[model samples]
Target: MFRISPFIFILIFLTACTLPFNQPILTEGATVPRPQNAATAPVEEQTEPPTAIPDTQTQPTDIQNDTTNGATTDNLEELANTTPADRDQVALVEALTGNDLPEFARTEPLDVQVGDTETFWVSDILNDSNYEVDARLRYAGPHVLMYFETAVDDQIRQEDIDRAAQEFEERIYPRNRALFGEELSPGVDGDTRLTILNITLQGAGGYFSSADSVVQEVNRFSNEREMFVVGLNSFPVGESSYGSVLAHEFQHMIHWHEQRRGPAWFNEGLSTLAEDLNDFGDDNTTILHIQNPDIQLTTWSNNAAQTGQHYGTSQLFMRYVYEQYAQDGGLAQLIQDDAGNNLAAFATMAQQTRPDINSFADIVADWAVANLVNNPSIDDGRYAYSLLPETTTPVDLELNTINDINQFGADYLTLPTGTTTLTFDGSDTVSLTGATPNSGQYAWWSNRGDDSVSTLTRSFDLRDLTQATLQFSLWHEIEYNWDYGYVAVSTDSGETWTTLEGQTTTKEDPQGNNAGTYGLTGISGKPGIETDQGEVGQWIEEQMDLTPFVGQEIQVRFWLIQDDAYNANGMLIDDVRIPELDYVDDFEEADESWEGQGFVRTTGTLPQQWTLRLVKEVGSETIVESVETNEAGQANISVNDGETGVLVVVASTPYTTQTATYTIQSETR
Candidate 1:
């Protein structure tokens, strides 16, 4: 006796379709005599021959004695009892009434011979076998044959079949054909039929079974080979999900026949594309690709860890390429091209669509850039879509108070005893003199406490300056035995310092001898060192030449130091100055001789540090050429070539800014 094992049960659920007879559904957990060739038999052996039963035949009352030709109903009870209870009753009804069976099943069974093979009725084998009938339904237009272990009427209705057929014909088929530019063929037996079996599909919505010869058969009606069989989950799934799965599997079938096979990424990517193309929109599973762009396209693995990203990125890449370069029938061309393999197919498509892009590497690079900088206004045709607007410009720095010290990138520190502050002392103010009014705020009293120190440090660029100077007003009260003050400068941005000569001082004691480490190395001076002890005395003007630091960037620091013994009122500093040279150029005079001279002057009373640059404006971009000034703040810039150009002379320092533009013509002296 022929027997269907559990594995075959699953295989049948994947590929079996309705013919013109009632197929005997194998029992769920029944032991029967296994066929001699059960292990080695081909798929055809598992499928019984077609059956024929007349419509006039009523439901049989006596099951045991009912026999027709070599077929007997003796095992009906055994078949019913062995199958699942829900399916057992339905199988018994099909066996008895033959009402819901196909029209072809109503005819007498025929032994049609084709190529020396005899075709027997499927019912003939059922009568002699111990299997039972489950549920079955026939759907025509997308030619679906649905089977389930539950009753057919209970599990699926004709309307469900109609909906499936309508979706496949109206949406899935047209979209897939349009994408691939190829006609879908029937299976090996000349039938474009889809056997949609209801089974427990683990971790999937549905699957296409390619191993079945029936699926691979040639369709006699369309005269094309069948694609494959579809297996759907037995549980209820919404029409949208069903439609998406149908389209997805159909794309797989189309791809299978088009190129035999390709890389998993391409295969899955195209199928996902088909799903969205069918108007199902992208499901949650595929959107992950865009969310995670780090995954490489070609190296996407289909395992559990990467399944979502792999599918998503693949679809994204394919869609990106399609929208950007292959709006024409390039994707279809890619599908049909016989490039031997997936990479070769891609290469061929890339070559035909974008000859400039050499390989997938270049495509990936451009794709990554598009994902990152998706600004269309500045895109220059690189990105396909714009994602964000332009970024905001940074605010310019302003000089206001000592708190605005940040403008010059300077820092003030009062260690162990005092805090740096900007305040006016009653007797002294820098603004009353030559200092800018905003610069009148003096560096007030430092720590009078023992072992205290105070510092004011700032850095400036003097690369283009011919001359510079540091000058300030100071008042101090220091005990001759313990405290002093000084000024220092560093060329290497304050990593080290060199104190200027004649800048340090200390008050004298009653004996008229300076006892502290005053006027030592690395010390500038104590300004009011001659004042009486404990007196915040007269302010003194001080100057330090900065010409040595010209043409170099440097930092200057002010220091107030106190010894471990007695400390008097500390120090006060105002009108601290690092003069930057300002440029005054006579372009008209220079143009007459192809030479321009500019004078740099101190913005205040002291010489300053400044940079001079000649900028040529070409379209929207400005190119800077450095110009050096002489000790007299004179910059003689020559434009030798005889061409009209827009030139800008810009001079800037940590303390001042000036700009001059000239529209000069080429003229000989």
Candidate 2:
């Protein structure tokens, strides 16, 4: 007689559209399985096919007579008796269901009330030590791209998947350190194990507090087990960008170990703060990258129905608090005070320590007014030509590793407390360089846009750039510590310039100190291609399309805004380049409708060659964006639901384009 294990059944059942969402529920007293030490190692290749044939010699004699459900009276007896053997088997099953248990020292079973909360204990069907370790590392290894054979519905792409994983790691890493201090190490105990599985899009992740249902979902499977599985043809980012997501998830594992529950703000905010890009030395000075609260902050504040208020606002608010308390080592104090507090108490503490905490809405308004304004220091007279709009000091450009040192100088950048410098050996290829602890600074370009005319000596061009990349190294002092300056660029040769994304930053907020250095720095320069653009956030290596500007005279300018009146601390910029494009555009224009009262279609054949951009003017941050057009020449966009905004339309062809505008209502919902 042949018998199939539950694990294989689970993998096959959940592969299609619907995943099992219902299962036996429990509260506490469930036994989760302990993991082995060897699980964290790299997975060795499996040369043999994964199949098991039952040991016929060990089979029970009555198996043929009671083959139904593959259970005999003896088997039923063991389950009913709760004997040691039976209990052990049960424990294994529970363990398999929940993936792995947290470390023993930090967690102990407690009597949970049925009405208040539910618990899961699935230890009955444990993956044998060898099996779990062997499969886990193989699936989770950094080099291997773990994905599904056939794509899942709305499945995330490899780039997005890698980014998601990296972002998760970034948020998790620092929280673990701050929460556990120095005691936390990933993959040390069975507690930190992760299960990446190939569940359908709807059932991929676990619920807020549904461990029991998760157990049942895990149990209803057979064939091929992955602690974590990619469903149908998934790939990871290239080796060059591997660690971000892994670090993120690992941090979650660490946080999950703690038995205490805190508010979502504290849990996620700290996680956002704790996310590190892994580029710092012992001395704590950054080498290449700095933390970006903007991503976390911005995403959190988008209040549309689909907008998430937790991460973005929390990250920004936490950053604000960190800036206020960082100097006095008040970060730990603030976190501790807010840890167990209820929402009101937490809000009170936040108000007292940082800003008022009416809600994320208030925070977004304040942030936009204070930081998003177009406060460029340079005026019209400052550029190489009189035609360009004025900009602030601090010129922006794309800088590469080699060219940065020469242009920005070595003094501007700092090595973390214990980080080493990158080096290029005789072979002429760059390697991660090592060095003693150090911090440095640079005094690069300032935007002449805000200054009196400076004659152009030469204009930056990208005609020779093919198969090359553009990157920039930049930094912002802790919030309000704005002693430093920044850089900007003009693709139109300084006639008119746009603020480089992430051109400026407020100091670190009071609650946290500076986020340590990171890799994956950004460029202050805009891409040569009009379609390929850059925005505010961490540094990036974006490709440029030099095709449009080839042989066309291009102007470039840099700025150095040194006004410390508003912020005493300084900013830094280094490196520049023009890189080749890696991806082609799949330009799909969506059908769009505006629900606002004042925004209706105008008559005039909709001017064929006009630029229609969605401009969201939030305080100082006015984002002027052009919408993609369809074959019918229709474009679509929407503003923040409650905020009134104007959509700017310009017709530049046939003659010098004239501008028109339409206002958006606060909310239609």
lDDT of 1 by residue, 345-446 (tens): 554566665676554444544554444334444333544542112211212211222221111111111111112111111100011112221122223333
Model 2: per-residue Cα lDDT over 1-669, one tens digit each: 000112222342334123221111111001111121011122222323212311111111110111112111112122112111111112332221223533222232222221222111211121211111111111232322233323242344556555545543454344445543322222221233233432221111111111211222222211111122221211133422233223323333333334122333344444344433232101111101112211222111111111122333344444444443332254444444433222233345446645634433233223322222223331211111111112112222112232211100111111111222211111111100001001121112111111011111125455554322223343222112111222223455344432222212222211111111010111122111110021212222222223444444444322322110011111222333343423221111211321111111111111222233343444555454444444333444544433333333222111001122222112222
Candidate 1's displacement at residue 425, Å, is 61
Q: Which regions of candidate 1 deviate over 4 angstroms?
A: 1-135, 142-153, 181-184, 213-238, 299-302, 338-344, 351-353, 376-382, 385-669
* Deviation of model 1 at 487, angstroms: 89
What's the C-alpha lDDT at position 316 in model 2? 43
Write down the TM-score of every candidate: 0.37, 0.26
The per-model lDDT (C-alpha) reads: 0.37, 0.25
